[model samples]
Target chain A: MKISNKKQTLAFLKKHFIMQLATSYKDKPAVAVMLYAVDNNFNIYFATHKDSQKSQNLLKNPNASLSIWEHHSALIQASGVVSVVKDAKEQSKIMDRLADAATEDESFWPPVFRIKGDEYIIFKISLSWARILDLEQDTIRQKDTPFTELNFK
Target chain B: MSETKKALIILNDSDPVLGRVCKNKFKKQAGWDTILSSTYDEAIKIIVQKKPGFLITDIILKNSVKDGLDLLKFIRESDDKDIAKMPVIVFTDLGQEPDKKRAFDLGANEYLVKTELRIADVIKRIEKFIS
Candidate 1:
């Protein structure tokens, strides 16, 4: 799907609900799977504990990159900053939409979802640029070895 | 805890197949081997003794520390300086911003989402530090 705006892009993400969150400092990169759910404003949010590394990182550095896509049709990739949510009302709404994803029987479910208190980090991406590439059309030309030319910021 | 190698490696996943696959791929460029520990305490012991080239730990350490993040804190506070430089190469299913920043903040050498790379790809990455 071609993304004309952030709303369209996030709409694509809402369909899949799974995303890879990439955060970095200096030269190192960190990636994690997130059960990403979008808000009315196309803002992305996910549940996480207060003690999580991602939370601490957000404290030190707010800038982040979030990629949400499916292999079947398209890939949704975007970069932005992450903010921690302290509001209880906001947290509850995002959690309810992701009821199925938060369950125990899923393939990639996180146990932290079962815990309470509704602590989480709401990642809002101010993407410099984004690309929604279809798998069939986007044949990666740089596929020599798996990690080759694979650069992360 | 005692370790024969310069680095200490830890993994939370108890799958037997994964341990073997990681070991086989690492044997070449690593020169040393990944020590399999299901818990954080066992990981600490090996780290104290072997002092291997590096620590390729999993994000969540089983039985002992709740997560690899805690074990990371343990290594930083250890008596040995070698353990300090022992770059943590996180090869886990857990990959996210906060965890990544925490790993880097805690001084991980590198962090790779397992879904992003295979055993062979990970071994190639380790070779960079070794060389």
Candidate 2:
């Protein structure tokens, strides 16, 4: 569904945790399931291994999109410019937020997967536009509602 | 290092724009992960699970199932001190004397009229309670 009101949009964004972040570099495109923390401007922050393919892709081409949903429905799809968060203080803040959100058990599995040290790259997606799609709703409503644009600078 | 905290915002309207603005204000100004819950059930669920650092809510929610007052009652009457004492700031257009009195009676830490304050001012008030 096309949602223009800020209240509903923010509600949808805050309710979810994971976002399918898609990035493209040259002819290759990649998508990764990431735990993200979004700021007021709809800028998304997530951590990944520095050597990860997504990181390499973003380096070459910053254009990206994110597909976020709840219970397999109410999808909020967004397109944005992506870049690594290089500021030390901002990096620490995002890393700490990620660490707080991560499960303790996740730490035991892969150290590289966790948001720790300089080994991980923190990527920030500055949203250009976004839209909502609710497949669970009726076809008429889905068809009538246009994609709501999220034009945040 | 200080632990990152979350805040819960309860509203009756399901407007996406306001939701984003509220979340952005709380997240950017106060550095709190703002969770927006449109329904009473959703609000209660997040309150219990997240134990948000604080709460900002509108009094008159369209959802008749349970309004913001019911949520306040739940928080105040809960046996959990953390939940019961969690700072609550009422942010709504309902600004009658009785409404304010009732909210205070229900243990609202602060009350703000939607018209009297700008969004920035609302966030400023929230910062006081959370920070």
| Deviating ranges (above 4 Å) for candidate 1 | A1-153, B1-7, B28-31
Task: Estimate the TM-score of every prediction.
Answer: 0.42, 0.47
* Backbone clashes in model 1: 21
| Per-residue lDDT over A1-153 for candidate 2, one digit per residue giving the tens place of the 0 to 100 score | 334655677767766657888887888889888777777667788877766888889888888899988653577888899888999889767755554444322222222323322355778988888877655555555445645666665
Model 2: per-residue Cα lDDT over B12-60, one tens digit each: 5533224544565555555678787777788888988989898888876
Question: How well does chain A score by TM in each candidate?
Answer: 0.68, 0.80
- For candidate 1, the C-alpha RMSD (Å) to the true structure equals 16.8
Candidate 1 lDDT tens digits, A69-126: 6664566666666676667675545555554343322233343433443234544444
Q: What's the true lDDT of residue A62 in model 2?
A: 87
Q: Model 1 lDDT vs. the true structure?
A: 0.61
What CAPRI class is candidate 2?
A: incorrect
TM-score of chain B of 2: 0.89
Each model: TM-score of chain B?
0.82, 0.89
Which stretches of candidate 2 lie above 4 Å from their native place? A1-3, A103-118, A139-143, B1-131
